[model samples]
Target: MSLRQTYRLWAPMYDVFLKPATRSARAKNLAQLGRLDGLNLAVIGIGSGLDLDWLRLHARPAQCIGLDITRAMLNKAQIRRRDCPFPLHLIEGDAMQTPLASGQFDYVVLHLILAVVPNPAAVLAEASRLLRPGGQILIFDKFLHPQQKAPLRRFISPLLGLLATRTDVEFEPLLAAHSELTCVRDEPLLARGWFRGITLQKHPINQHPINHHKD
Candidate 1:
């Protein structure tokens, strides 16, 4: 089954299984935004709009856009949008390559998405592309440390990836590919460090000092 089909079936019970386990971590990850007044934010792979309530409580962004591939998931998010005070727009679209304009957002959230997508690097690159320079990306998902031997996880990653999420993804290599993004904070959140909360900031333009020489 395609990932979208898998998630379409999973959407009905997604919150039932995920909400309890991820509630605290989600709040903690969103907290990193630290009062987002007048900032434009995008939540890529915003499954079931679980983050909306937290955003409503913690931030008053100028606008927040959520994109997801599954219509069933977007339907759930639509229901949750009614209570959100900030402007919330939900789009049924792919995370790897969104239709949104480039460098228009102040922040991007990628909770529980990296491991779920087929090309995590592409999604990360897309998120980076969507952000304005100096904007930050907040990620909360599971990752494996380089050279860590987890035979079972590596073995089952292929099968699990088809149905849900990948277990063998390494964060370092993905981050390394995007030189413009700098890791600011990374900490373990759940499952004995299997799941992590990471924050990345896109480097601003013209960082080098300009030399002023009079001829």
Candidate 2:
């Protein structure tokens, strides 16, 4: 099924569906963003804004923009809205093709989104493009680690992979493979049996100096 169709089915139960199964899996990813005060933060495929509380408590970002392809998801987020609107922007767009300009953000965060996209590399490239020099990006999603424990990951992971954006895709090496971005942190919040969470820094794409995004 297409991501939109899958999301159409999931938009209602997404938080509940993810929470029970991926609770331990998603916590640290949420926790990692708390320190990003005053930064321009853009979150792609931000489902229900369930993680907003954690992000706000931690990062205190100067602005927050949430983007998702499904309007239902964005509408749901509006109902769950936290008290402060502090520079909040909502855009209906695809991660692989955003309406925003290049190098237009200080940080980008994706929570369990890549695996389900039709093109994970395209989304990653977008992540690379939207980020300003020295900008940081955080990704929390499934990875089919060849080096992992077999018996455990064997059962649950394939299902996650099946449900993930790019079925059976591996994002672990892709994050490390790129020279433009540096791996600042890698943590396994789940059973560490299968999936992994990653935080990476966007090194300057070129010799250009930092030209941060305009509001």
Candidate 3:
């Protein structure tokens, strides 16, 4: 089944299963935003608007945009919109390539999304694209460390990926490809370091140092 269809099927029970496990991690990651008084934020792959629940408890932002591929998931998110202090806009779209303009957001949240997509690098690139210089991307997901031997995870990743999310993705390579993005914080959140909370900042235009190689 396609990822959209799979998630559409899971949408009805998504919160029941995910909320308990993710609540504390979500709050901790969102806390990294520091103050949300007037920032423009995008929550990519915002399934069921669980993060919105957390935002409702805090200072309001100027606006928050949420994009997800599954219509059912977006529908559930709509119910959470009623209580948001900030303007919350939900769009049915792909995370890999969104319609939103580049450099328009002050913050981008990628909660439980990187490993779920077919091309995580593309999603990360898109998140980076959406951020203004000095904007930050907050990521919370499970990732495998480079050269770490996890045979079972690698073996089942394909099947699990088809069902919901991939289990074999590595975070380093994704971040490495985007020279403009710099990792400011990375810490283990759950599952004995399998899941991580990472924060990345976009460097100002022409400010990231370039490498020089002698030939």
lDDT of 2 by residue, 85-162 (tens): 466677889999999889877779888787767678888888888988877788887767655555655566456544
Error of 2 at 164 (Å): 5.7
TM-score of each: 0.94, 0.80, 0.94
Q: Give the TM-score of candidate 3.
A: 0.94
lDDT digits (tens) for residues 110-171 of candidate 3:
99999999999999999999998888899999999999999999999999999999999999
Q: Which stretches of candidate 1 lie over 4 Å from their true place?
A: 205-215
Candidate 3, RMSD to the unseen true structure: 6.4
> All candidates' lDDT scores?
0.90, 0.71, 0.91
Instruction: Report the Cα lDDT for candidate 2.
Output: 0.71
**In model 3, which runs have C-alpha deviations exceeding 4 angstroms?**
205-215
lDDT of 2 at 175: 66
